[model samples]
Target: MDPRDWLARNTFHHSAFQDLRRLVAEKERQGLRLSLCIPTLNEEKTIGKEIMLLRAELVSRYPLFDEIAVIDSGSSDRTREVAAAFGADVYESADILPETGTRRGKGENLWKAIYQLAGDIIVYLDADIKNIRPHFAYGLVGPLIERPEVRYVKAFYDRPLAGAGGTRPSGGGRVTEILIRPLFSLFFPDLAALIQPLSGEYAVRRETLERLSFPIGYGVETAHLMDVYRAHGLEAFAQTDLDRRVHRNQSTGDLGRMAFGILQTFLSRLRPGGGAEALPELHAMLRQFQARDNAYELVEHHIVEEERPPMIDLPAYRQRRGLPP
Candidate 1:
């Protein structure tokens, strides 16, 4: 399908899904179970509110979500405690698949959630959104529940950044605008239609999620878009407009590290089979300069975008899902 046609057909507004009763009825008619996963590092302040609003609105009042889980990355803060206090089922990421060992990244928590949560569809929301709302969950899942062909629904919104001057409107983010967009436009033009490819909020079908490999770092979102588009084309995806998303912004140096990881993943997908294993050994070090008291110092960060194989390939996941080995 043409990108414009796809955009016209697939792009949606969150308001289109505000009727929770209709959405819930459709979900029940389809016999679909929905799970919400909030991946956290240290988001104690916001995690509680996100869980509270989502659980109260989606779970308690509407029964749109079967479970609301916080898959924590062993936060030193009270993120898990706060989530649990608000009636969310909390699980430490490492504890879910102890046999495979632990890798500390948001993607790791997301990949493990597929194994830990019992739902036909899983919605992933970042733990750091200050403007927490139930629409963040239901809006993404509405497309999946209503349309069987849409295996993934990505969230796009007006990102408002707070500054000394005032609030300024922004597009996706620094890394997305500077790096990912150009890369996608060059190679994966169909994916460029997505307004916010790097947004941390999306809902994906369990079957589709399990079939794709995961990069356990900043590269995960980019990898998912490439793989899904490659496998199912742009028709398999839909995007929802969530209006505004408020959150903390990362500094340029941190974005540099993220960009480095994302670039590594993007280059690897260019090869035949589009697998990380096909690439030659590449350096994982991200070197940046820091100005310290009239002097420039080099700071090196080791950011290897290690990948986990498809969840369907894992024997443990298959056993848990009761699929034939």
Candidate 2:
């Protein structure tokens, strides 16, 4: 399909799904169970509000979500406490799958959520959004609940850029424009239509999600888009315009490490067999410089883009979901 045609049909705005009553009616009519998963590290400041607002609106007021869970990556801060205090069902990522062991990353929490939560459709939202709102959850899930054909719904925000005439909507952050977009345009042009492919917000069907491998690092989101598009094509994906999102920005050095990790996952997917095994051994160390007392110092960050197998492949997950093992 033409990129423009796909965008025209699949793209939507948050306001389009603002009628909570109608969304709930459709959800019940379809007999769908929704789960909201907020993946966190040290987000005590923001997690509480995110849970409070979402639980009050999506859970209490509308009854749209069956469960609102916070899958924490063992934060030393009060993130888990605050989340639990705000009426969210919180679980430590390490505790969910003790037999498989744990690796610290946002993706690990998300992978574990598929096993721990009981929703047929899982909506993942980052815990660091300062401007928390209900549309963030409802908008992403609306497409999946209403359109059975759409297996994944990604969120995009308006980051205005000044052009020759005036300001217009830009794509995602630095790494998205500089790296992910160009890479998608070159190899997977259909996916390039995604306004913010790297956005840390999306809702996916359990059947689709359980069948996909997750990269437990910065590469998780990137790998998901590639794998889903490869298996189901662009037709199965949808994107929503969330208006604006405010959050802390990462420095160039931090983005460099993210870029490095994302690149490793991207290259691995390009191989014929398409998995971690397909790629040759890669150096996990990322070398950067830091200014200390007006002098430069070398810093090495070990960022391995490790992966978790599809949830459906696990006997425990199958048993938990009451599927025949």
Candidate 3:
């Protein structure tokens, strides 16, 4: 299908899913359980507020999700403590499955949540959003419950960069505009319709997520959009506009490292079968530069874009999900 056609059919606004009670009733009638996962790394300041709102509004009031969980990547603050206090089931990354080992990244937390969470459909929310609302969860869930064929629902937001004084109402998707969007325009045009391609808010069916390879780093979200598009085509995806998202901004240097990881994942998917005919192993370390007074200093960031195998391939996961072994 043409990219414009896909955008017209797939693009949606949060207001369209305004009836939370109706959405909840449909979810129950279909007998589909929902789970919410918040991946964290030292996000004490905002994790508390996010869980409080989600639990209070979605779980207690409306009963949209069966479980609200926090998969932490070794937080150094009160992120886990506060979330637990606010009634979120918090689990450390290492404790999920000790035998398989663990890695440190947002994607790792997400990948493990699949095994740990109990819902047939999973909704992932970023832990650092300062202006998080209930819509971030219910909006993404609405499309899946309303439309049976929609396997994945992504969130697009007016990402406002927060400053000391206040927020500016624009400028959050730097890497998406520069790297991911252009890459999509060149390679996967249909996926270019995704407004916030790398937005960390989305709800995905468990079957879709379990079948795709997960890049356990900055490249995870980008990899998911392309992977899902490859598996199910444009029809499998839908996006809902969440209006505004307020969050802290990263430096240009940090974004460069992220782009490097994303580029590695993007390139690996070029040729059929992970480009095995031409591509070799991708290097884990990412090299960058910094200026000290007058001289330029080289900095090496070990950005290992290690991927987790599909959850369906794991025996433990199958047992947890009660699938045939």
In lDDT terms, which candidate is top?
2
Candidate number that wins on TM-score, 2 or 3: 2
Order of models, best lDDT first: 2, 1, 3
Q: Please identify which of the two predictions, 2 or 3, would achieve the higher lDDT against the true structure.
A: 2
Q: TM-score for all predictions? A: 0.94, 0.94, 0.93
lDDT of 2: 0.92
Candidate 2 residue lDDT tens string, 61-144: 999999999998889999999999999999999999799999988889889999999898999999989998999999999899
Cα lDDT for residue 321, candidate 3: 81
In the range 1-325, model 3's lDDT, one tens digit per residue, is: 7778878887788888879889988999999999999999999999999999999999999999999999999988889999999999999999998898988899999999999998989999999899999999998988899988999999988643344666454423889889998988888888888878888999999999899888998889988988898889999999988988889999999899989999988887785764445777778787888899999999999776889999899999999888999
- Flag regions of model 1 displaced more than 4 Å: 159-170, 273-281
Model 3 weakest 10-residue run by lDDT: 163-172
Residue-wise lDDT of candidate 1 within 154-253, one digit each (tens)?
A: 9999632333676565468778888988988988888988889999999999999999999999999999999999889999999998878889989888
- True lDDT of residue 73, candidate 1: 91
Q: What value does the lDDT take at residue 123 in candidate 2?
A: 99
Error of 3 at 146 (Å): 0.4
